[model samples]
Target: MTSSLRERRRQHLRDEILAAAQALIAERGYAAMSMEELAAQVGISKPTLYSHFSAKEELVIAMATQAMERLFAVVDDGDPPRRSALERLADLLRTGVQVQMDRQVTAMHLWMPEIVQMMKSRDESLTQLCRIDAVVVDLVRQAHLHGEIAAGLDESVVVRIFYALFMSPNVARLSLVNSPDPETMPDAVAHFFLRGVAAGKA
Candidate 1:
């Protein structure tokens, strides 16, 4: 069914608000982002912003939830034995990194203690995150079975480490050399992580 004209306009504004929120949260940590600032940045009144999102936490949760929904849709599961577990894992990592780059924020931002705490109360956001983690856990197990990951590394630890690598932008900032080009960061990061956890490397 087609959306009514008013509904379409409302959704367009909602998308605009979420895009602004992503950039603001990327520039300032979520703890520092304010609804008032977001409203002003979007050229909307506070009441207008509040009309779409009831609260700051709700808005942030909506943004993060949308992100996870996109990630869930695009990540390949490497079904039917077409790819090695290692290959599949690398693809997943690259997709995730590329997503953060596109959004100008990292998953690490969403995993911050305060954000995580806030998200616990948002069932849809929490569920989407769990779904992503579940896929990662399965991939890690498959990698281990295929002798791709280093022997004896705990699956949970590997999974956590995989998530931690999403913070590569912070690490890149501290580098003496120039940061990895955004175009190559996905492959560079995926290679770095996979090599670190390779069967004989760990």
Candidate 2:
């Protein structure tokens, strides 16, 4: 019982460390989040942090891995509740944007060769990414078939539109022309994206 309790406490501390790292990465880019800063932020010694994560890159990759796992969970839930592919895709998009803005995370940034290489060395991160791509493309096709999107628009174009609108890192300033606040920015972008693909919408 004592050993089990100790393990649980260790796991809890590791979770706290990851949470701190994620928050810092949101405020500052991954490249800017240092080990010393992370340790200080988590209120742990450098040696303890090192024991949890051998290096910064490893921690960042772990973050990406967790993000991807969550995304897959979102994607998996879509079709099970018998939701339309379009609705499923929208849920995925909104949650994805929230993850990036709030948690400073997304597999999108992991496409870099250095990071990709690390992920590839893991439990098939590349395969997981490809699976996500396949799911997105399939969803686009479903939306097009159901006339949820504009007429005559190719699947690729629709995919690009969805990604461009949903993947804003600095989203607060996104509506400079229309002058919407950060809170309204997400809805505005969603409207624009959907409108472009919306049937009979100008």
lDDT of 1 by residue, 19-125 (tens): 88878887896778899999999999999999999887787677667766666765543456577777777777787777666665544566457777788777876
CA lDDT, every model vs. true structure: 0.78, 0.73
Candidate 1 error regions (>4 Å): 1-3, 26-33, 76-81, 105-108, 171-180, 200-202
lDDT per residue for candidate 2 within 143-202, as digits (tens), equals 888878778888898888777766664343344554234455556665666667777889
User: Per-prediction TM-score, please?
Assistant: 0.80, 0.74
Clashing pairs in 1: none
lDDT of 2: 0.73
Q: Best candidate per TM-score, number?
A: 1
